[model samples]
Target: MRMRITRRGGLVGLAAVAALLVGASPASAAPGDASAYAAKIQVTLLGQPAVTAGPFAEAKADGPTANSLATVHLPGILDTGVLNASASRDDQTGAVQSKASTADVRLTVLGALGAEGAGTRQGVGNNTVGAQLIEAECHATQQGVAGSTKLVGVDLGSLGSVDATPAANTTIQVSALGVDVARIVFNEQIHNADGSLTVNAVHVTLLGGVLGSIGSGDVILSSATCGPAGLPIPMASGAGLWLGLGLLGIAAAPAAVVINRRRRPASALAAEAD
Candidate 1:
């Protein structure tokens, strides 16, 4: 019963698997979806002029939905004050939700190295037999003046569960006087196969990193997408409407009381046979 689409990011099945990730895709959408965005910078090389910037302050929603977005800037690379993504569904009772969030985060690349954040969030929720996942970790910080190092999220969900369905990629390697020079990512969940869900919190894989030319890339921040928990009520499609209303109250409630006493009249059956 709530719908919004201005802070759009995880647009349907994670932009159809992010246009196939470096190349991704998987969006046909169903189960009332949700979306949000705060940043997306895609640069390319090989030929050049392919420096697409932004997916900023984006939002999307459908059916029982939700979405939110606040500020964003892409001067050096990225900046955020608040960005939230959401996906929703009520489906008569089988609730659902999907979300992504960001706040006071900043980034700066090429001008040095890049990474910073005061916040970041990811989500996934479901009902009608169980499904749950929502995180507010990811308070990363790497502006240590000599490069960054301060992470918290990514403990494999307390070292036990794992249900991001088919998507969960997190990596960050940006070193300097020590060596390693690129690769940064932070993904949340994605259980799409129709049961929609796509969260790409942040991803940057510019093909121009280290070599291969100079520009040809990727960047996405605070993305969110929702579910596909198949809903139709009646205990989710079964019991045949409570066994056809208990055989229509045990065989039609006495054939309507003997057809209302044969429709009366015949002088009320000859005045009850006087």
Candidate 2:
């Protein structure tokens, strides 16, 4: 006898297997800065795909520590969203201080065929999804220290589905001591299934004048599906099904063989009695 599986049943089974393989962790707050007069930021996801939506934000600062200036959450089948932070600190002599800001902060999710599959094929629908930080600024001033850094035309990170070509671009600029240190830009041309794509840019400016010095920088971080909260396993057709079951120690062949052997033994015993 042959066994048949429905699409919905198969998906549920696959999801269960994925949960067992990847496990699940409760969401927690983002960590604080390691040093005084420093700024820190983080993103977290709440639940698994097709179940919960998230990518929450928790930001903090010290020594003129900044507050969560603004935050946006775009939860979906998978957790996704962004956070921003801004703060300023100054010294008694006014010779030392720091000001910083982060924007377009977000998390992303993408789907791809499992390694066991033959040709490469992305998941259907919106396989690429993420948030962005339109801009960020960090400025520091110190006396007697003269240094500069710059980043321009560099790829910070990418968002959107693998099935569609990205149609967005991102760029960054950093400067110090009256000189351009870096000018970086990242351009993407992937097509989006929903025909929606956006660009993000971060600009940093640092100045060290006469006996004073300054520093500034920006960054774009990303993960496979969820954010720092943890890696949430994603589901797709073809290889995804087998991969999930295999990881859970329930390979199709062994299970099928066990069932067949059990049925054969019962039938053989009945025939011998007759």
lDDT for position 172 in model 2 = 35
lDDT of candidate 2 at residue 9, scale 0 to 100: 45
**What does candidate 1's lDDT look like per residue over 4-115, in tens digits?**
2211221332433333331111122223444555566775444435557666555554532444556666544455566655445555533345455565554444323322
> Which candidate comes out best when scored by lDDT?
1
83-172 in candidate 2: lDDT tens per residue? 333333332222221222233332222111110111121321233222322332222232221111122222222221221112233433
Local accuracy by lDDT, each model: 0.43, 0.28
Model 1: residues >4 Å from true position, as ranges? 1-32, 38-57, 63-73, 79-107, 110-170, 177-183, 186-196, 204-224, 233-242, 249-251, 262-274
RMSD of each: 21.9, 24.5
